[model samples]
Target: MKGNKGLIFLSLMPWLCMEADAAQHWADTSAGVRWSSSFREPYNPEKVSKTILNVTHVSQDDYGRNFLFMDYYISGMEDPSKDNATGAEEFYGLYRRTLSYNALAKDPIDSSWVKDVHLSGRMDVGYENTQLSPRPFKVRMGGLVDFKIPKGSLEWGLEGVYQKSYNGITHRHFEFDPSFVTWMSWNYPVTKKSQFSGILEYLEAIGEDGFGNDTKPLTIFRANYIYDIGQPKGFKVGVGYEQFNNKYSSNNAADPTNGSDQKTFVLLGSYHF
Candidate 1:
């Protein structure tokens, strides 16, 4: 993925129009570090202690909304890097855009419990230097519905996309397969200075992977309780729990001893500006 810099630029071209046509609503950038001891990679038996540096941005405009986030997994051993004798690092980035149906339509659908709908798109790109050396890129097209709740809201989305991968070691492309994705997200105010939020996402199986292993549906769930420590400056601290199953589409029929399913608690701190 690092070598295909041009493709990254081309993929992001659609977002460039926002600056010219959209009126700014609200935007926030946040940085955080999270640590977990149960992080797993496919086929690996060891549950490694992972340190992740995260950067995120969320914004909304009169027309729609956008979310962009990146994660950097840090290593402290002398494993992958030779010159500096550092550990291997992995990176993943994602961007999502939603065009509001209510804002664009002259006659929008409205009900007591339904808020709005959106046409949504998302792009996921990732690279890892571990044994599989997988480089994944996916694009999803879908629709989302926002439903009004008593004190919060629920958002549900579904998408269809094809997964494409490049093998760094083999210098070849993997078999292309179609997949479906769906997710539900929600937030509720726990207090004036705190909130409870979570997202549960599922990815349907896309048959065999590059390694000739049968793939299974994947599930990822995360919940967080956050407090605004610096309300004036938008600083926050939070704790989270994450549950992942059949990570990276690994076959569930394989050994349970393999670190394919993981549940872990995370420590998080972030500053938004």
Candidate 2:
């Protein structure tokens, strides 16, 4: 079903990134793999292991910048995928376009703290091969305030979007609602060989879910301190702390222990090219 679509998109990502690199002023792409065994299953209280393969691309053109990332998740057999009847696999991706006010303005504002402002458009798409076989799609429109930092930068942004979701169990009968999201991201150099970076995002819940359960707000937070290994940008490794409360906006009424909350440490590695 949706997994087929996700597979096609993920397979073509490399080619798309290469084309964008040739057409953009500046472009960079990174491939990273991460794994964790501390994740919990929703509704059912049990620990499961998950591995993720992530590919990210960022490019700047005459107008502004483009950013995209795709994640492929493989879970243990305890949560088997519908397609394979074994481990579950999910694909999720996000694409963002930032139209810079400074780049288009006649006279750009040069304030001390505010580096630039941007009107941003974002799209999120995801598909999972679990029993539910959820397909979620959303489009966001918002603005971002970019601030300058010593040898680095930070971005604070907000988005308002409508979510349209379909699942195998509920089909298309579930209620769709609009949600507001706020996020912050920053990266700073701790030393020449080390850097601190992370992202914090909060999503306001919409209406009821597929099961008619009242959806809850979602919070995702990740902070990492990465150290460069060999060359300047060749190989890197880091450890990070991650937290997810009310993940996927699912309110675990069946499991009163809040089995959905995930606060764990993750090991990360990446290569930039």
* Tens-digit per-residue lDDT, 131-217, candidate 2: 788888777778899997667769999988667677787566353587899999999989999899999999998888887778888
Clashing pairs in 1: none
- Give the 10-residue window scoring lowest on summed lDDT in candidate 1: 76-85
Off by over 4 Å in 2: 1-23, 173-175, 252-254
Q: Which residue pairs overlap in candidate 2's backbone? A: none
Per-prediction TM-score? 0.89, 0.88
lDDT of 2 at 257: 57
Residue 200 displacement in candidate 2 (angstroms): 1.1
How many clashes does the backbone of model 2 have?
0
Error of 2 at 81 (Å): 1.9
Clash totals in order: 0, 0
lDDT of each: 0.80, 0.81
In candidate 1, stretches whose alpha carbon ends up further than 4 angstroms from where it belongs are 1-20, 76-85
